[model samples]
Target: MMSDQPNLVTTCTFKGKEYLVKMNIISGNSLEMSVTDKYTTEEWQCCYDANYIENITHKTGNFKQFDIFTTMLKSGLLKTSECVSLDLLTYDDLEMLRNRRMNGRNLCPSHSVHTNNVNSTSNRRYLILTYSVEFDRIHYPLPMEYCGPPDPQVLQGIIHRLEGEVERLQEQLKKQAEQYPTNNTSHISKLQKRIEDLSAENKTLSEDVRYLNKALSKHSNSMRHIGMMKGIVNSLQEQVIRDRMTSHRQIKRLQEEKAVLKQQHTSSETSCSKCSKDCFSISDSKCLLFTTKFSSLL
Candidate 1:
């Protein structure tokens, strides 16, 4: 539900123009605010949720339209004005207006509808029909002060002050122009000297960088050569290991063959000695037989 009466009514200056601001509390504790220009009668309205207002108050939200309002509210620039509340009579009139239609499109007049018959001198007014973006129709009375144009005297005074400010700025500029040449010459010289020094330093740094790059290249080549040498050394070490293993196996086989040859030679010598002894005994037996036969024949 929304309230018929405005919660707050205040006068504030927005964008250098005086405006009448009205705030109403709507459903879910949201705020519906309307701002009407005092001179132009132009109106702008916006609805802010409770969380949105909280964020704006906490400086976390950045709504350009309402940021100035929040600032003015905090700075006491929004002067609170008395709001004419809706009475029973005014409520009945609003109900009737809601039903009544001027055309087929349900258009309402901008003027207020008063039910009471009061004296002509009584300047008290009631609801004025207005339109808002959030609501189709809003009943709020415009303040009397906001209905007319701005004071000419105030505008003239502002113009006069601005003219004086312009003259003062022009004088300041003229004085600066008079003094600029000497200051600029010295500043330019100093800048040129600084630039020359920087250039020299940059040149030195460039040379140093080039030297470091060349040294790095040489070191890289040396590292690659060292890696190649390491690979060659590893290959030679492996070949030496294989040669030593082969030589050890060959030595073991030769030793085994020599031992077998020595055993065979010892057996052959023993057999030869036994055969010679047998030959000598046979020859002696044959000679004795021959001598016995000759003696018998004689």
Candidate 2:
């Protein structure tokens, strides 16, 4: 027959905290554990294989929380208030046992067994059974005791490991501090050399600017001198054209005076020749009359 109640109910201390632990056997002989925090009222469950109970009873298994609970039970740290026998036998095994007992055959000496009452609390009995069936293997009950605090020696070991880690970190910081000054000095020298080179380049650029300004001033004076020379050449050309026009008018007046004088000279010469001829004729007549008078006187 299957029961709804847990096969074992007990209390245990895990990691310095007290908790209520309940162990149940479900169908197929599987074992389950339910753990609850007494102060916080929080609960959780874990199921183990059927072989886990067998391993625990033999005191040989992978050590985990369940193993710690068993260890605490052996050390009288946890207590059990209710205990019941775990039914490990299958249906076939029970049927075979009944048939053998009915046939009047001698009963197996190994199957005959009884439960042992280990402790009592509040009018309750705690029983642990050891028996064997078809497999001929003996099963032992899980040990239990009253609840208590965790051991002090385990806490001391944790604190010692933490102190060693802190010392190692402090040594690393000291080494970094010792190396900083040498790196800082080399970096400052490189920056000062760069500043000096930039200052020399700036001085050379200032000298070139002064030379260009002097050359531009000389060019401006030369352009003004060329403009003054052009104005003088234009005045000289205008004076030469005025002198040529005066010389042409004087030559034309002298030619007209020479022509008038030549005409007057020709007219005077013609009058003089005619008067001389007339005078000669008058003289010849006077002479002729004188000769005739002389002849008459003779």
Candidate 3:
């Protein structure tokens, strides 16, 4: 029974002071009270012993919502056309008249529908709602004397409309959540890991570029030194070749001078040999006379 009932909130006047009434679930005619806001938890106060909230009484002894609505409906006071047809009342007056006539239910109105076929009853308002809606009054054949609140079928329709609204809102929320997917820790971790890997790779590439630049500089220096050495070697080779040519010319001139000296010596030796031959040809007989004359001439 409690599950079928919705918590109700409404304004009530107690001792000329407006207070809020929260019609909480009850057990065996006990009316529960909420003190979370207005009173301390230690107090835990309850004010009524009525089995049903519709039977609750206020300090002012004002008629309960059920009694008021029934009275107004019976008296034709709730018919808007009838209320407005009063020639003296303006629009504002009509609005106030309507509000006054409503008298608003003190507790959320819970009702049941009686099915004739099954002879069973079902709770009309099952959802946990705290408010009521303004439904269009339907024309129903009655005794011409406005009876109590209309048929349970009308309340059931309002309940169905409220339930439909709740369902639609729930579906829309589900669709919205599905449209924007959630981010899990693992996905975030994966992104962070990828970023870290890229950073490391970039650092390694930077180091490699640094090393390459240094190597290039060193290689360039080595190439310059090699070029200088090649130039020196080429100059040295050219100087050595000139010195060799000069030495070769000196050797050729010495060989030519030696040949000329040999030729002069050979001529002198030939002349000496001829003179010796002639001396031998003069014999000893003429030699003695010739030696005496030659000795005198000498």
What does each candidate score in C-alpha RMSD? Answer: 41.1, 57.7, 50.8
Task: Give Cα distance to truth, residue 294, candidate 1, Å.
Answer: 4.0
Q: After superposition, how far is residue 18 of candidate 1 from its true place, in Å?
A: 97
After best superposition, candidate 3 residue 217: deviation in angstroms? 11
The per-residue C-alpha lDDT of model 3 at residue 167 equals 45
Query: lDDT winner among the candidates?
Result: 1
The TM-score obtained by model 1 is: 0.24
Per-residue accuracy of model 2 over 42-133 as CA lDDT, tens digit each:
44455655566556655622233444434333333233312212322223344354566556676543323222322232222122333334
For each candidate in the order shown, give its overall lDDT on alpha carbons: 0.43, 0.41, 0.35
Worst 10 residues of 2 by lDDT: 118-127
In candidate 3, how many Å is residue 218 off?
A: 8.2
Q: In angstroms, how far off is 40's CA in candidate 1? A: 93
User: Sort by TM-score, best first: what order?
Assistant: 1, 3, 2
Regions more than 4 Å wrong, model 1: 1-218, 295-298
Clashes of each: 0, 4, 0
**TM-score of each prediction:** 0.24, 0.22, 0.23
